[model samples]
Target: MENNEILLKPAMSFAVLKILPLIFLALLFLLLAWYLSPFFVFFSIGTLAAGWYRLLYIRKSIYLVTPEVVRISRGIFFKRTDMLEIYRVKDYVITQSFILQLLGLMNLTLKSTDAENPVIWMVGIPESDVIDTIRDYVQEARKHNRIYEIN
Candidate 1:
């Protein structure tokens, strides 16, 4: 059908969970700077830099589900893009942890036949019918490709 229809773009806020420890350490360093040597301020800056790096990495990731394939592009300095043919998709699972539920986000994991990247996780996806859409597309692709599951 059409080429590259955008499917899901996860929110950058997903990085919050990943970078939370760095942020906490940065705050601690800041507190230390207030009482101890000013050099602790530099440590705080370093932690913040690390957090910023993680934020950019998450912000740059994209998940696209097309009629024939699923495209996942991720990275900041070294970008890598992966494509999983929809016909190769075997199953999918959606999960929402307690913190993710509170943030109104969920994770979508796709199981594929591709040997190199069999499992792909789409995190921080906003709550919606995304799984349904992907499932529909997977079926359509399988039909179009004449793919059948023997087992």
Candidate 2:
């Protein structure tokens, strides 16, 4: 956390894809409960709970990019944090699906030398200059550490 310069949080749009279906199902169940049996009310409650869980899970994720390392923190009940040295970053890719493009969000995938999590995906990031900022930091960190990729 030394001089951490940038912090990125996934947009709530990340949960839309996942929760949308659940929401529809919940409404369907509610309609069925209103017209048919009361047991469907329980199903509606369950679907709503699942949607809520997904929202909380997505909301809890955070990404921090520092000059020396990238920190990823995610979890709902049990928090887990991972750090990838900026110098270890080998490559990165930005992907935008049709829905994400419509939402003005993109996913960033980073290939790094970290053994535990070599490929990290940061989803629902806004379409912005974050990639350029990270690239600059990675270059600076590699130069400062005197680290060079062979291939």
Candidate 3:
């Protein structure tokens, strides 16, 4: 694929903590329904369905990092593909919340020159090595594309 050589293909998964609130709410509903009636089973099932749906969406997300560009394809029904030229990536930040840190997950936020989608976030990357690889690729791409900034 020449310039389209795939540098890193990272999976986008939702952290367990991110979905904890949904599970908690589902349990709460189940408890409340326990006192009311057996109809609460429906709410429990609905909660499970919602959680599964969210997971399915994340599973469907695609993140491809190449020397020339970064691509993200997301959404289930109405799919979307966002591309950011590697040369236009201004800076990137790797962040991990307390829960994410505990789970060994990280979020990579890339700030690019693209005005429409200046900020691109790739979350739930399972390893720190992926972050380092992305950083190196972005730097290499910038050099390859002769991108420079003067402060």
User: For this target, which candidate reaches the highest lDDT against the unseen true structure?
Assistant: 2
Candidate 3 residue pairs in clash (backbone atoms < 3 Å): none
Q: Against the hidden reference, what TM-scores do the models get? A: 0.91, 0.92, 0.80
lDDT of each candidate versus the true structure: 0.87, 0.89, 0.74
Q: RMSD in angstroms, all models?
A: 2.0, 1.8, 3.0
Model 3's alpha-carbon lDDT is 0.74
Error of 1 at 131 (Å): 1.0
Better of 2 and 3 by TM-score: 2
Writing each residue's lDDT as its tens digit, candidate 2 over 1-151 gives 4554788778987777768999999999999999999999999999999999889888889999888878999999999999999888888899999999999999999998889889999989888888888899989998898888886
The TM-score that candidate 3 achieves is 0.80
| Candidate 1, 19-98: lDDT as tens digits | 89999999999999999989999999999999999888887889988877889999988999999998888888999999
Candidate 1 lDDT at 28 equals: 99
lDDT at 44, model 2: 99
Candidate 1: pairs in clash = none
Tell me how far candidate 1 lies from the true structure as C-alpha RMSD in angstroms. 2.0
1 or 3, greater by TM-score:
1
